[model samples]
Target: MNSVVELRHLTKVYKSMIALNDVSLSIEQDSIYGLLGRNGAGKTTLMSILTAQNFATSGEVEVFGENPYENARVLKRMCFVRESQKYPEDSKAKHAFANARRFFPHWDQVFAEELIEEFRLPLNTTVKKLSRGQQSAIGVIIGLASRAEITFFDEPYLGFDAVARQTFYDRLIADYAEHPRTVVLSSHLIDEVADLIENVIVIDRGSIIIDDSAEEVRKRAVNIVGDADAIARLVAGREVIHRESLGRVASVTMLGRLSSVDHEYIADANLDLAPVSLQQLIVRTTQEGPVDPSAAATEVRSVQT
Candidate 1:
């Protein structure tokens, strides 16, 4: 697959802290990428640099094979829908959409109108007066209607209810099918977007922990359930990510594929195997010490949207 965006040795720093450390990755064209990570995991910083909203401390970034900084040619081909988007104090939702139409050359007014009705957004109300969920809907509408070559949605469903979020997801899938493009979505709700993302990138503590296809990532770990002693012996040499015990029964999540011998042992021990979901796998992979209390604050101050 052709890469629409490339990051080479990308790094970001805030005073004494490193937000992104020697990161290198590629965003393939015409696919949905899930940027899964906890707060202060550099997801926003990476997106900010790609969109030219923020500059990398060091290293290189290429969007559509060219530097995105101050480059209208590249910038116009990408859209960054963020929760912190700002609007004129007096401007209504209509004004925002109209402005978006002007900025996004491929903007579809018809689609925007359809989304407005579907989201039941109030066009007359000033953006500041609208509810948080309603405000988020504005960004979602622009993201879908803009139809940019590479769109970045950074936690776009901030305050949305389950139904509203599902609507966004359903529309995203439907529209993406009819019009394929590169989409980089950053969200904390990992499970909710699991089915939507074709590729998964897990960032942890300023580093890339897992970068692979969703299907492959799902297969990276397996959960074994049975007698505590059997599970302990089976997983003795394996990398255990998570474990649970209930009296004599133990459930353990371990990395790497099971071999024929291991399978036979599991069968002999009457053990059961369960598939790991994307969310659970990610949680276990990134589970560690508490994040720096100042990391989130620094990112908030440094990141531009």
Candidate 2:
């Protein structure tokens, strides 16, 4: 498959704070890539650099096989829809669509109009006067209808309700099936988009920590559930990602794919194995260490002293 975007040793810094550190990644063409991580994990910075909205402090970035900075050819083919997108204070949904139509060569005015109605956005109302959900709807419409070859949605569904969010996902998948362009979606709502994404790229504290197919990542770990003692025994020597125990029942997740022999061993041990969800796996990998009880006690003692 062709690469739509490439980053080599990409680094971005702001004064004393490092936003991205030696990050290198290649986004495949015509795939829905999930750029996932916690807040302040360099996802937004990376997206901005890719779309030419922000400059990298060091290293290289290539979009459409060319540097995207000030390059109209590359800019015209990419759309970056972010929660912080700004419009004129007096602009309305119609006004935004008009601007998008002029910028994107493949803009579909008809589809944009349809989406405006579907999202129930008031055409005459000023964008700033609209509710947060309404404002998000406007962005979603443009991002989907623009039909840009590479589209980036940076938490674009912030104020939408569950039903509206579902509609956005359904429409995105349906349209992508027909159009087949590259999409990079950065969202904290990991479980919601798990099925839509074909690949996952996880960033942690300014570095790329996980990059693999959604399926492969899912298979990298397995969850076992059974009697507490048996489950503990099964995970005793493995790299445990997460563990939970309730009464006499326990569940444990560990890294590494299960081989045929391992599967047989599990069956012989009578422990039921289940596939781990993408959200669970991500949380395990990216979560900070458990709270320190001793530190909490020390703070309390200091207050008492």
> How displaced is residue 185 in candidate 2, in Å?
0.8
lDDT of candidate 2 vs native?
0.85
Query: After TM-score superposition, what is the CA distance of residue 100 in candidate 1 from its true location, in Å?
Result: 0.6
lDDT of each: 0.87, 0.85
The C-alpha TM-scores of every prediction are 0.93, 0.91
What tens-digit string does per-residue lDDT give for candidate 2 at 127-240?
899999999998899999999999999998899999889989999999999989999999989999999999998888888878888877777777888888766666565567
Alpha-carbon RMSD to native, per candidate = 8.3, 8.5
Q: Candidate 1: misplaced stretches above 4 Å? A: 289-305
Q: Supply the TM-score for candidate 1.
A: 0.93
